[model samples]
Target: MWSDYLSAGFFKAFEASSGIKVNFTGIDSNEEIINKMKASKGRGIDICSPTNMRSPQWKNLELLQPFDYSKISTIKNANPAMLRVGHDEWNFGAKGSHWLPMIWGTEGIAWRTDQWAPPRAGDIPSYGDIWQSDVKGKTMMRVHSGMLGAGLYLETIGKLEPGAMKKAYDGEPGMRKTWQVVTDFCIANKKQVKLFWNDADSQKNGLLNDGVVVGQTWDGPPISMMNNDDPVQYRAPVEGALAWIDGMALSKQAENLDAVYEFLTYCYTPEVGGRSIDGGKDDSWGGKGHGYNSAVLGADQYASDDYGKTFGSVYPYKSLANLWPWPKEPQWYADVRTEYVNKFNAA
Candidate 1:
């Protein structure tokens, strides 16, 4: 849905203005990007999106090349904090950034408003809510992330050590110790999950058709549905939304350098960024948008009114300050985490 939305909305406009057609492919996870690029050594893919934390692993793999910043003049329109992440972390050899921030959002709770409400009427839901017997056999989540949320919930209730999830980044021993506890807890309650979503479409289907009363999901998909009058709402949980920045990376063996820079330049424009979030009843490019925040400055001004309202509802009480920013993952951490995920899925 993200690929199609961007292709139909801003990518189409970029084509009209620059005369360069984009061949877009929607990918579900960072592993997919890594595998596809590794198979070809980045030969066929010109630009690919990887979340910010995944940059270190991709950098270690030699799958990406540093961007020539001079060519992307419109980059000045990007949010300074987001740009700093690229410069500080993705600066391969400190020569230049290999990644540029594109879209930013959080993974949190989305529930069927008609079927379930938070335990407290006005309070934000907690990650622990998904485990309660009330919603058993009526929930959905992704394997890896749902376990992370379970760890967070355990932390909140004193079941696991404080900061257990974040400490998983410290080393393999600590990660295994912490994740084992989380895995046990999840396996014990695995019956609660009716579906495990891998992408936005699966998430939408789980909520609207698979009888999911509540689920962990990205902010974009459910918000898109809510705007269309689906009986659903997405909000940051009390443990904080797991935040990440999706980045545009240049392939090491990119064949279309000019087109790559053109696409980045086009994306960094404020109007393009804003419209990507909400197309504002524009029939030419579909009436809706991706339903997430843009990293470009002044992009909000051009977004539809629904964007403002939805933003308020989702981030009420300045919960943006409560976001749990994802820490960079080493290759070892990612590998071990995958093992735990596989175990949970099999159990």
Candidate 2:
């Protein structure tokens, strides 16, 4: 999946000049990939792209190789938020550059323009809106446990209870309120929700087919849909959206060190970074080069024709600059996913 969109020509050009063949393999899921790496005793794969939340597993399994940034030149160009060298011990030692930030984005709402009015500036809708009877069956949401876990937080918004946030994160309070809101919305609007989607393509199709008036989705999908001639719009909402920072790291068992470095270097190059930000490709890996909005180009040469207006206004890059990155706690992910799944199932 990661290799399909990589500019073959760009890699081939690198190979022609560097005499290194990039051996790319496709894996079906994170679990399968982890199993394969473990089975190999950390000797097969050269590099791995894992969520920060999964770092503890890799560290505990001894599957990750400590990165030596002394050999890499692109680290200087990396965004400070994207770089996590000295943050903590689990983060590849304080100075060892094992994990390299790859992409960053937020999870938010995407709605059909035909069905909903454009939200006023600073008036973004939130999870609470999904429970409104008016739009009940008209909504769809991500079924992933990580995303649904956000519901627990949502339920505490208007409550007078103390420690609600901590309770939700701890999975004690559970996602009861969030589930109630979502289930009530879904049940009332049973006829409106055309389908629930687990993938981007499905969400786009739902929006296009008029199956869903609004849905919880990542920033990328709605942007891509609007670019593809769909009337979808995205918003961060008042409650704030979820953010993630995925990074790249070399495997402890990797045999092709030079090839791995070459690949990382290629990814960090200005051209590659620019293309990734401009939506030149689809995969999540490339999109991290630029910020959330497709309009902000690190290099002027890479900007699209309407870059000036489109990048800032539609995407809201300036506002996101101050937002915090998701914490790199593995247990947080586990707890959230579990609570989300439980609440979703109950709903």
Candidate 3:
């Protein structure tokens, strides 16, 4: 089972071809999925999808089995650049094996273009827009693994030194003050946030139905709103978008192993992946780059025209340089961020 945000539904074509009834489970955040894996002891779940940022935590816990590239024939079609960006395989595992990139995207402010404009503003949206005095009681944000909010808060206070962020995730010296700044900002502006969301529907509802003018959000909700004729836009804030990749991983002890492996490779198929996003366009014109791309072969052919105009995609799939994924660290930073969130939620 996997998160619904990865794809609208499991690929029926794969099921049709393999005669395997693909079972899927959906959740909003990586932390929730991690908790599920822990509670279940990763039993019965043949395969699962998790944001690549969580890969470090998963691998450290030995929660996932080594993905044998020697056997998964379909891996030949995957993006070569993404083969193994992290992990010290030789010492870490038999070969330091782990998950693969399923889909990639960024987190940013989803604004109602009709409701607010940039301060200096023709069109480019900035992360600071969410903190303006006029927007009080009408903004929202998300707790996507703790980093997205950290990025925004750090940028807001001018403490976004790259090395400082790495230290922040690592819980090093001086990072505590930075973390305190963020936590204090959170307490101060708790009332400014109309809501904090974790799933797609909450964000979609917060923006579309609940009168939220500007909120920290993922790319999907704003695009879904646009498709429904809502004037909305998702963009990389001036501080930059928080980029991360999501992909599938096999549990160490899974039933139906053969079917699980088949489903893993089947998902990378271009027709299946491309069609799943952007309402089945399966073409370059799919709804504005979607901020994600397949890790498999022929993914380059699906780049978006709207996003390509701004280099969101190239001949091959890629994320913008300004987009930052999670900082590499041994400890899962969500443990820290969730502490802050719990207090805020209690308020």
Judging by TM-score against the true structure, name the best candidate: 1
Of 1 and 3, the candidate ahead on TM-score is 1
Put down candidate 3 lDDT per residue, 1-347, tens digits, no spaces.
33434442344455667898866778776667788888888887777777665655666666677677766767777766565753332124655556776776667767888888666543556666676789998988874333345546566566665546556765644555556666666667667778777777788789878989988787656765665567777766665677766777778778887887777677677655554454344333333223344566675454333434333312113236666666654453656656656765665
Write the number of the candidate with greater TM-score, choosing between 2 and 3. 3
Per-prediction TM-score: 0.97, 0.74, 0.84
Give the root-mean-square deviation of each candidate in angstroms.
1.4, 5.1, 4.0
The lDDT of model 3 is: 0.63
The digit string of per-residue lDDT tens for model 2 on 87-163 reads 44346544365577665566667788877853456546565555556676777766552234234334456432433
lDDT of 3 at 132: 70
Error of 3 at 77 (Å): 2.2
lDDT against the true structure, per candidate, is 0.87, 0.56, 0.63
**Model 1 spans > 4 angstroms off:** 1-7, 281-284
lDDT of 3 at 3: 40
Which runs of model 3 end up more than 4 angstroms from their true locations? Answer: 6-10, 86-91, 144-163, 282-291, 300-319
Which segments of candidate 2 are over 4 A away from where they belong? Answer: 1-43, 85-95, 118-123, 145-167, 170-194, 279-301, 305-308, 314-324, 332-336, 339-343
Ten residues in sequence with the least summed lDDT for candidate 1: 1-10
